[model samples]
Target: MADELKRRAVHASGAGLVALYLLAAQFDLGLTWDRFQLLMGLLAVGTIALEFLRLYVGLELSLYDSLTREYEQNQFAGYGYYMLSMTVAVLFFEPRVALPAMLMLAIGDPISGTVSDDSLKFVKGPRVLVTMFVVSALIAAPFLHETPLAVVAAAIGATVADGVKLRIGDYIVDDNLTIPIYAGLLATLVLEFGPV
Candidate 1:
């Protein structure tokens, strides 16, 4: 339980990036969207470099033992995928679409994790899926209120990402990577083509 809490804490810390992105803009800190995307890209690059060192160069860090799951020992960790997804979100989507998606990963995922059972399976339980949908919808509401359909779609996308574990050959796709991208893509599609 303590370890789970620690993992969730680290997961929730991703919200700090959202806070910084919003606060910097509100306070005129000159961290514009382009600059923020660049920053995320740099983070993704750094994460990839670290993952290469860990996977190929046989580098071992204590942080990995504490935070990563057993399955992640040989592959890229969730944090790497997380940074990559976040960078892709900001770079490809508008703020109205991206911010809510990011929040769904940062806040909604942690909440879902807390409510989930400790099963190392491919799919979460129905209760956890419901919780993820509700939380993700609420998180996206304020940002996507003008387009309620988009909000619903985003929530559904986020829920699906959290509920199911996708595998590409031997690698299990992390929700950390899928949640924001799915939500952002769904929201963007609705905003672009759906009736607002």
Candidate 2:
């Protein structure tokens, strides 16, 4: 059941991204060749570095160094989420991408975490996904050209991504992956392509 939700969540997120890209293409909204190059390069570098840390060196840097450790230890959630979220938000010109990504952190992480217990309540399986949808939509509103519609899309995207996290990302995500992705995708999009 959990795995199914994870698969569905990924499908949702992927579908949303495809929809957004199609919408953008229809509108002729796109980053220039330069931006795409930069983003891809950055993504490649980031991926390689993360693999090194994860496979070669191992988990040396603790999630504890991350502000997340405090919240994880005390089981108090949403503590540093906003600050970190905001920092990442500035990267992408597309509210669509930003919102879903943000929701992954804000809603998905805390809501699904074992914080105090080994299991979660509202385990209808959709709980975390639903929460991601709601929170991502709220955060994405003001950032998009079509604020209202984009918000809805972001929410949907977030929910889907959260559901897929376990199956797709498989917990390979962390600060290292986060940084390079942010720098690569968002930065390139904004710098190379005008704000979407």
Candidate 3:
């Protein structure tokens, strides 16, 4: 069950990614579209093939599905997805060492939730998010150099993306595309265009 569950999520994520690929083509017209096929191949062959083999080994694939269902019910599945995505990204492609950037989001989420809910009223909502963002920046400063500015930019971008994604997905959209596109664009801008 677990293996099957993992395969389902992986397939869904792959399909979502393929949609993103098509959308991305709109941004860059006249590009030689060769690599897109490669991506599709990886999704259809690599990710699914490895998982299918798990069933032959007598491993319980249903458990993955069960856990994913549980996580969806509990509303904390984002953490698992994050971990899985990062691990796969690192192991498979080695692109976007954006852990520091994403950790800002992960850490800021709980902080924002706490203050926004008044559970930690001693600290203001915006302030707490900012402070967490700042601390994450400080921790990443040595490596990123322009840490403070980068963190602030990412926080603002993430906030806007989150809000916009919800509204956009609410009408004629799949919600799954939000975070990957969010992270992808943010990574591109920060790593490729940002002054830092």
Candidate 4:
């Protein structure tokens, strides 16, 4: 029970980053995409280095226990995947696409996770998917040009990607990586090519 609460707190903290980005944009804090990319890159590198140490040098950390699962014992934690994907998204896409993508990844992923927990009294599966889609769409609406279609496609794509845990041989692909890349790609493609 304590672990579940800690996990939720961590998820909420990650979701809070969406607000920081929004506030920076609103307050005109000069938070450009380039700077954001730099930030994410640094974080990604740091996470990778720490994970290496944790695996090789016997770096036993309590925080990691709260954040990671047995699947991540010899792999990068979700936070690493999150930073890496965010950096890639910022680097490959323009601000308009990347911003909404980040918002969906930051906000939508946490919402889906928090509500999907079985111990929370909610037992319906479709309800979780619907809630995830609706929340993602709302998050993307403010930034997406074709708000309805683009946001809907992004929401569906992200939710689907998040639901499926992929594996390449022995390496499990975390949703942290899939969520932003899939969501950003779908949103960008729909905005660029679908239904002008």
Candidate with top TM-score is 1
Model 1, range 1-196, lDDT digits (tens) per residue?
A: 6777787888788888889999999999999998988888888899899899999999888887666877788878887888788888999999888888888998899899888886977889999999999999999999999899999999999999999988999877888999999999999999999984
Candidate 3: residue pairs that collide: 1-61, 1-62, 1-63, 2-61, 2-62, 2-63, 2-64, 3-61, 4-61, 5-65
- Report the error of model 4 at residue 122, Å: 20
* Cα lDDT listed for each candidate: 0.89, 0.41, 0.42, 0.74
- Pick out the ten consecutive residues of candidate 2 with the lowest summed lDDT: 171-180
Compose the digit string of candidate 3's lDDT tens values, residues 1-196: 4454454444334334433544676677532234544544454454344344443443445544533444243233443444444333323321223443344344433333343443523233555546544554453454345444554554454444333334344342221223333443454466567775
Order of models, best TM-score first:
1, 4, 3, 2
Count residue pairs with overlapping backbones in model 4.
Answer: 0
Off by over 4 Å in 1: 120-122
Clashes of 3: 10
Q: Per-residue error at 4 for model 2, in Å?
A: 24
For the record, the alpha-carbon RMSD of candidate 1 to the native fold, in angstroms, is 1.5
Flag regions of model 4 displaced more than 4 Å.
117-124
Per-residue C-alpha lDDT of model 4 across residues 76-181, encoded as one tens digit per residue: 6776777777777778877767766776677777778766755423233776778778887887788784557888887877777666667799665777887778
> Which lDDT value does model 3 have at 2?
49
